[model samples]
Target: MPALPTAALQLAGFLMAHAFWTASDLPPGGHYQPQSLCMRADGNRVLNSFDGTNPKEQDEAARAFVTGGAAQWPDCAIARQVKVGTPTGDVDALVIDVVQYGGSVMTVVQAFRPADKGFRLLGDELMLGDNGPLPPLPAAQAAAAMREGALDHPGMDGKWNQWETERDPVSPLVER
Candidate 1:
């Protein structure tokens, strides 16, 4: 056997890497969804400069905060906003959805209220798999939606199962 040339070895490695990446169901950068690449949060806390008077500013601020939060999941993440009619007015509620390689999709549903400064975090819930884009709604409507399964997270219905077949599970807890 003879030693391979350095250039040939490097080219072979590069080709293998490229092939593995191209064959996977990941974004080009193997980081996140291109559509979800909005303004990232400064850190864990999202400070929006919006005055809450203008709808456009409020939406921009909300999206920025959501994107920042979703940044924790570098592999793949998405943010969603849902309008819930409240007694005061309509508010933009945000959800951060993240899916890791060979893991279940996780979601963090959050509700925020406008504060004197910017916005105040009201509450958030962690849900397994694309279970919701749930916004703060009336108790009756929320309950009924949950009961009737009307609130099932839309899209990517069986895509996870397909991915499972293509890749190994991240952990033993993942569905077999």
Candidate 2:
């Protein structure tokens, strides 16, 4: 078995040891379900930043970590926040209430990230959340969403092919 990264282990610990049970609450065929985009940590500590209201350039959270925050190691944004409620619990566990703007309405997507699984969007394991939790995922799902987006990480074409070889059913969110 692959040695789970410490981050992944911690994340799993957070979910299994700390997180609580919650429902998907989404209406049938709802597009605003929670999303999480978990990438693998290459070396040391994993790094991350959210897209928030802007999709241009990496956000400030990333800058802080990239500028040598805690772990002076290679970092990747493996986890995302999806609020299920007002954040509660100690550092060990938290429930976040997911929020996303749709036609100017901020819809709440109750979601959470699990430690064992990559991401949870509600029904299946997820890789990326649309806005964070309620829906967790495997990384492949997030890749699909990115492909369906207007633009994508240029040098990652080869990466997607590699993922396809490993996982199937890429989400339509990805572009061609």
Candidate 3:
């Protein structure tokens, strides 16, 4: 086993960790599962799974990422007591759940807005997996697949069986 790529970016200029409130916390939709980062990406709604089983869900997701989607949306915000992870912090370990549709092999999404000061739409912050046409796996399996290249092991399970497969939509889509 090796240190997750997140550790490599502790001092990364792009690092924007909010905080760690809890483990196994679920996001808005049933699809986006809870992890270290509550991000603005497609599978974020897919519950961390880059699956396209539900087109309606994914469509809303795709537009969101391309058009400054979710990050711009504002709901009556609730503060989560997140333990912001840092390279020099007391937290010995870190895990950034990468989830993007058409970017790197590490599952990351691009988060930004049209104007530097305007609100972004939550829908525009999400994009489903790209690169190769693929299917969705259960949430647990999705997390495992994300760890493939970056880990000594990169494997996932199907509905009820362990599976070995290639990971794509691994990185976040780069904006122009």
The numbered model that scores best in TM-score is 1
lDDT digits (tens) for residues 7-117 of candidate 1: 222222222222222223333323111123212233121212323455455546545544454345323333444455656566534444343322323444434332222
- What lDDT would each prediction earn against the true structure? 0.33, 0.27, 0.25
Tell me the tens digit of each residue's lDDT in model 3 across 49-93.
222466344544443343342233221111111122334342211
lDDT of 2 by residue, 14-126 (tens): 22211222122233322121122222344332223334444222233433332234243221222223323333431111222111111110112113333244333332133
Error of 3 at 45 (Å): 27
> Which candidate, 1 or 3, has the higher lDDT?
1
Compare the candidates by lDDT and give the number of the best one.
Answer: 1
Native-vs-model 2 lDDT? 0.27
Candidate 3 accuracy as lDDT:
0.25
Note the residue pairs that clash in candidate 1.
Answer: 41-68
TM-score per candidate, in order? 0.28, 0.22, 0.18
Question: In candidate 1, which residue ranges exceed 4 Å CA deviation?
Answer: 1-74, 86-89, 102-104, 115-118, 126-176
Query: Total clashing residue pairs per candidate?
Result: 1, 41, 40
Clashes of 2: 41
